[model samples]
Target: MFISVVIPTYNRKPILEKCLKALEKQEFNDDIIRNYEVVLVDDGSTDGTLEWLEKNKEKFTHVSCFSQNHLGPAAARNLGVTKANGDIIIFIDSDLVVTETFLQCHADALIKGEKKLGSDRLFTYGAVINTCNFDDPTSEPYKITDFSAAYFATGNVAIARKWLEKAGLFDTRFQLYGWEDLELGVRLKQLDLKLIKCPEAVGYHWHPPFNLGQIPNLIDKEIQRGRMGVLFYEKHPTFEVRLMIQMTLLHRILWGILSLGGILNERTLAPILQWLINQGKPQLALEIARIFLNWYNVQGVYSAYRDMVKN
Candidate 1:
């Protein structure tokens, strides 16, 4: 079976090169690799990324490069999927390095029927290994799982093309970052599709510390996260059982209060708080407000009271 590897990249040229080299070393049979195609979606990077891809196109015959305007990673991935010609689709971030057995392990799982879910085939599974140190003797490898709300790490997973078609692709409305994966995972669960945690299918994620100047962007991320929280609760109200989902709005409120107290590191909380406050309490809005304020043992009584009056 052909495996389509979709890699979404921004301006990280060095990291992208590392991931490509690892792909070149897959231990899977030559026939599989020959059948497999690597689709690189460049999300309108200004770092000469397109030129680089053009220059290196000869290195891999199966590598297909595509470019689009400055859309987010989620949109870029959807574009890649449209161009893919494989039965199974594997998504690996441009910042990760895979083991030689990466493809082989996931393929084996599917073929042997070792992992599945309900009446649907088990298509999606996690494969990221995030560690503090890459070479430290004491640093052990980490595997991604859905044991908790924070389980689905980034885009280092594989899924069947049919599954993507059935469950829908990544939500493009999540313009920039955060919560898109969680939203997808939630949808998969609702569809009764199992997302297994395959430790043997491993890859190392190289995440560097953000620079101080990137704080604004980080805050913008949190704001987008808060917005996603709003959408998430609207879609899956049952997600209240998940701590991350439960605390979604409250987390923003807490951060705002903490910022006011001069104890928080992020500065974008104030704007986010102001935005949420302006969203006026509909019934669901009032519920979220009460939940947000109640988490801090604050008086949500007035907001609830106001909501009742308005309604």
Candidate 2:
């Protein structure tokens, strides 16, 4: 089947370069795979991504670029799907770099899954190896932190285009940080769609090493995720949704205890975190910082939920 890889990016030109380059080197032919296209939707990037793509279009022969205003990824992805020409759509982040055999592995798995299931009511989720090594992301081994049990994440997944249309795509209201994809997964699950793991289709998800300078941004993201979590629960309103958003008493008590009721916060933990960074263990420092980061998330969720109830 033909495939359209949809990527929604915002100010991620450096990594996007590696992503597109990897796609351009896919080891698939037009016979079994039929055809494949990379549909890149730039979500109003100020990093001159559009101009760079235009000048370097010859490097990516299979790429088709589009642009939108500063709408969130949900909107940008909707535009990508609307413009895609392939029946099968692959969703990936701009920061992910894949192997040359990535598409072939997904295609083989999809074909096998369709044959085994007697229908095309399944999506293939690939393995994502997280790495802080930008120069050689693909060389990084899989770590425990990279393990994800998510049913459907946009990091590296392939599905029938019709299923996404049936699920009505992502809700634009989740424009803050997270849960937009999982909310759509809820609808897709209702439609009896299955997720098939395709371990061979590996993608290396790249991010810079954790540092003290990134603490503020990471905290802000957790807060945004918390607010968006409330929106997710509002749409689904199921026990599963509550657990996913961490709106339940279990999460509240857990984070509260871990953070010592907000006493062990950024201010209190700054010295320790900085010491870890100085010791060349930024990853460990980030992990330790999660104690307060998650506490902020729990607090933010409850605060937003309370505001919603008040209104």
Candidate 3:
């Protein structure tokens, strides 16, 4: 079966070139390569990426390039899908180094699966061999049986074209980052398409060293996080579940205030607190106030007040 590898990249030309080179070394021979195509969706890269693609276009036979406005990766990927000619789609981040068997494994799995409705193939999800060396390999891949829209690794995932068409594309409402994959995975499950965790189909993720520039604008990022939280609650509404989420946000807020006062060093606390405040949920705000003895709650209130001033 032909598989189209869709790589959505933005301004990371050097790494993207390496990614393409890795695909060139796949275990699948020229016949498979001829059958397959690499769709590089350049999402409005300003880093001479167009020139780079022009320079290397001849190096790979089936390489095709598409350009669009900087509408983030989700939109870029949706565009790539529309242009793809293969029966199956393998999505690998531009930062990853794919193994020779990567594309072959996904194709083989679908070929091996039992017959299903509409399409005879199943959706295959795989884990990235994280170069950060942080993930616990001992953890088994578990079935996602909840409405939380839980998904396995996003770095290396494959899906049949029909399944994607049925499940619908990633929600562009998510805009740039976070939770779109999980939301789509939920929709796929709801459509009764089986999602299997293929642990063997591995790729190396060269996680870049931490840089502050990679961080989004603090308030804007928190607002997006709050928006995701609100969307999740809207999708799966339950008093207990909502309470738990609010409490988690409250804890993060309290911890953040404490850390700012030199009482703690939990780095994520501040952003978490900021997100809760941005949520603007009255009940959540009241809960935050009640749990932290009014003092820290007042601090959060004042912090938010200061943020508005800065804006």
Which has the greatest TM-score?
Answer: 2
Backbone clashes (count) for model 1: 0
CA RMSD for every model?
9.7, 1.1, 9.9
> Candidate 2 lDDT, tens digit per residue, 1-311?
89999999999999999999999999974466989999999999999999999999999999999999988999989999999999999999999999999999999999999999998899999999988888888998988998888888899999999999999988998888999899889999999989999999999999998887888998899999999999988888899999988899999899999899999989899999999989999889999999999998998899999988998
The residue-by-residue lDDT of candidate 3 on 27-146, one tens digit each, is 863343346788989999999988987977877676789999898787888888999998888887887777678777776666555443346645777656544222322132322321
Which residue window of length 10 is worst by lDDT in model 2? 26-35
Task: Give the runs in model 1 whose Cα sits over 4 Å from its true position.
Answer: 29-34, 114-120, 131-140, 143-154, 246-311
lDDT of each candidate versus the true structure: 0.64, 0.93, 0.62
Where does candidate 2 stray beyond 4 Å? none
**Candidate 3, 189: how far from true, in Å?**
0.7
TM-score for all models, in order of appearance: 0.73, 0.98, 0.68
lDDT of 1 by residue, 1-311 (tens): 78999988999887777677778777875453346788989998999888987888777676888989878888988999999998888988887778878888777766544324334456546456553343431133554331333434446677778877788988887675566777777776667666566667777777553233444554455445555555555566564523454344564466457445333333333444345446641223223333333332222222332344476
Q: What is candidate 2's local distance difference test score?
A: 0.93
